[model samples]
Target: MEYLILAIIGLASGIVGALVGLGGGVILVPATLFIGINLGMIDGITPQTVVGLSVVMMIFIGLASTLSYMKSKTIDYRSSLIFFAGSIPGTLLGAYVNKGLDLPSFNLYFGILLIILSTLLLVRKYLKPVEWFVKHGKKRSFTDATGETFVFGYPVWFALVLTFGVGFASGLFGIGGGSIIVPAMILLFLFPPHVAVGTSMFMVLLSAVVNSITHISLGNVPWLYTIPVIPAAYMGAKIGAALNQKMKSETLVFALRIILLLLGVRSIIDGIWG
Candidate 1:
């Protein structure tokens, strides 16, 4: 029954992940907490164990979604590499920090980040760029200039900084890091939303792998549980990607924001009251 519940959750998470370029960790964490509490795994050390296991499972989820994106040629390898360069080191540092932090503190900080990310997603529409400015303070005056400015996207330095922050956050929270990266790439990097989703999956894949290794080294992962969750997640990712092609961009963004907001609120409640 535990395995069955996890499988269902993995499928749902995979669909969300593939469609929005998230690792589904925001959903997974809370779901796992609910399940763990029900199963009486809420005792000392078990909640952390569930979190560690969930992170390990997300590594597989990211890989599966990345493969689907790669097959569709949606991944931007150059941008992914730049993001990975910073995220890899940050993930390692985050893993070490996770080892030292208490569970409540971890949950509280993680919840706060999610809330901030959710709010950002909710307000993205209103924050759309009205003008494009170059590093030299020159603003694009023409519509064509605006389009061209965003065509290839933001400068490489900006991408690097964004990636590093996402990676660090991923490590700190034991998540796939796509929640922050996908939105950041689309909103700040000026990449097409779909392309950002695909590219973010690739970055999540790499970061998850690094984080998984750290988790394993620390004996924090449960391989038995991860095995079933991973494959289901991959299959669900493919299905979600297909659906993404048929959805309106605005609708998808709105749905993602609502989901994030709910998850953020849930995490906060669980951290404080559970």
Candidate 2:
């Protein structure tokens, strides 16, 4: 019965994750806690265990999502490769560091990071308009506007540095790395929103895979929970990628931001009350 409940939560999370670039962390973590409580796993250390399990599950989710995007030709493989170059090592290091940290500290830091991510999502729309004006300057057909053109707008070295930081946080917090990578890609690398989402998903695939290994090494993941969620997440990703191509840019961004804010708030409240 508990597994059934978790599977349902996974199904809902998978759908939301597909629509947004989040790897279902916002849904998975809280759901895990709820299930853990019901299953008598709600010891003081349950949150950390939940995070570990979620990160492990995100590996499969990211891979499944990336495959769907890849089939649609939405993935920017070159950029993903560049991001992964830095992220792989960072994930390992983060996993090692996390293995030594206490659960309460991890929860506190995770909560703080979610709050920061929520603020970033909330402000992205306003910032984008300003950035669009600054970059395009009333010309929509500028080099940046050409959908066919791809450029590494940021210094490659700087982007690599940022990728490492983002990946480390992802590993530590059980996130998709999209929350950090998408904004960086848009603001720093000048990727279009859709491309940023696609590229970030690909990058997340690599980061999650690397991070999952670390979690496994630590014996922190719950396979019983993960096995049933993978296929549902994959299906969600397929539907999401298709929907993404049809949505207007402004509408998608607006919706994503609102969702992020609500999820973040819910997560914070759950953390406080749980």
Candidate 3:
């Protein structure tokens, strides 16, 4: 029964992660904690174990989504490499930092992070790209299937610093870092939305690999539980990538915002009162 629930969670997370380029850890980690620990449905669940499992799932999820995006030609390889340069070390740092967190503290901080991410989703459309980043940084362009062209870029140094922070968040929280990266790409670097999503997934894939290795070394992963999650997430990612190309996601995103907000509040309450 626990395995079944985990599979379902993996499917949902994969779809959402692929749709938004989040690498699915945002949904995967929270759901696992709520169900396995908060609800007492599974044994031996801890924040560290949950993070480890989520990062492991991300390895497959990121691969699936990144491969899908590759066929679309939306990824920026050069920028992704630059982003990776900084993210690797940042991920290592975050993994070390995560070892010190207790359940209540982890819940509190994770809740805060979720709220911030939810708020970003809520207001992202209304925010314009930062002209300074676009104007002063390097320039690059992409031509989409519709023959529409987008010009965008940032300084290599800035990208490195930005992705470093993103990697830290990913390793600390066991997320893909797309919640922050996607927004920065669109709002700071003026990347085309599709390109941002694709590139962010690529970065997520790279960071997750390093994050997983770090967690494994720490002995945090619960290998048995991952059996059901990996395949389900991989399949769901394919579905999500297809959906991303076929339909509008405004309504789904709005729903996701509300879900994130509620989950964040719940986590905060649990942290304080449980």
Candidate 4:
């Protein structure tokens, strides 16, 4: 019965995650923690353990989203590779750091960061955007699987630094790196929203895989908790991917921004009172 409940939770999370390029952390982390506490089966589940299980569910969810994004020819592999160069190492380091963190402190800090990021995203949309740095990078173009080419000029060096920071937070929180990556890609690197979403999913896949290994080394994950949710997460990812293509980019970003704000507040409140 516990496993059945986990599956249902995972299913809902997977769909929302894939849709917003969040890899399900916003829905999964809080839901799992609160519900697990309510149920005796997960009576003593630590934040690290909750994060580890979230990683398991996200891996499959990211994979499903990746495949769907690939079919639609929106993934920007070149950018992904550059970001991964930094993200991989960062995730490894973050996982180790996360093992020692207290839940309340982590929640407080992470929530603050999320809220800040969400504010920045919101501010950039309606206000005059300030140029962070001057980049004279050369424009580049790449063709995707469906013979569609995307051309853009981006600050590669800046992206690397940012990706590492995002990866660290992702590993620490088991968010699969998409929460930061998607917004960064769109708001920072100037990628089209759809491309950002697609490429972010791929980055999430890599970050989650690396992060999961670190969690495993610390014994944060239990196979039984992970197994039941895998299939449900996968199914949800497929549906999310389909929805992503149909939704307008502006609409998608707007929804994600709102979700992030809510997640941030929830974490802060939980940290303070729960």
lDDT of 4 by residue, 1-274 (tens): 7788789888988898999888887678777776775345555577898888988788899899999999998888887788878898788888888888887876777778779878878886775432442244546665643466655556677777888898888888888888888877666556667888888888888778888888888899878878778899999999999999889778988888898898899788777876
The deviation in Å at residue 209 for candidate 3 is 0.8
Most accurate candidate by TM-score: 3
Q: Candidates sorted by TM-score, descending order?
A: 3, 4, 1, 2
TM-score of 2: 0.82
Pull out the clashing pairs in model 1: none
Q: Say which prediction, candidate 1 or candidate 4, comes out ahead on lDDT.
A: 4
Cα lDDT computed for each candidate against the true fold = 0.71, 0.66, 0.84, 0.80
lDDT of 2 at 76: 73
Q: Which stretches in model 2 have alpha-carbon errors above 4 Å?
A: 38-45, 100-104, 128-152, 270-273
Model 3 lDDT at residue 230:
95
* N/CA/C clash count, model 3: 0
Ranking by lDDT: 3, 4, 1, 2
For candidate 3, lDDT tens digit of each residue in 23-93? 89888887888888889987888989999999999889889998999998878988888988888888999
Q: Report the number of backbone clashes for model 4.
A: 0
Best by lDDT: 3
Model 1 TM-score on a 0 to 1 scale? 0.87
Cα error, candidate 2, residue 179 (Å)? 1.8
* Deviating ranges (above 4 Å) for candidate 4: 38-41, 129-134, 140-151
Off by over 4 Å in 1: 38-47, 128-152
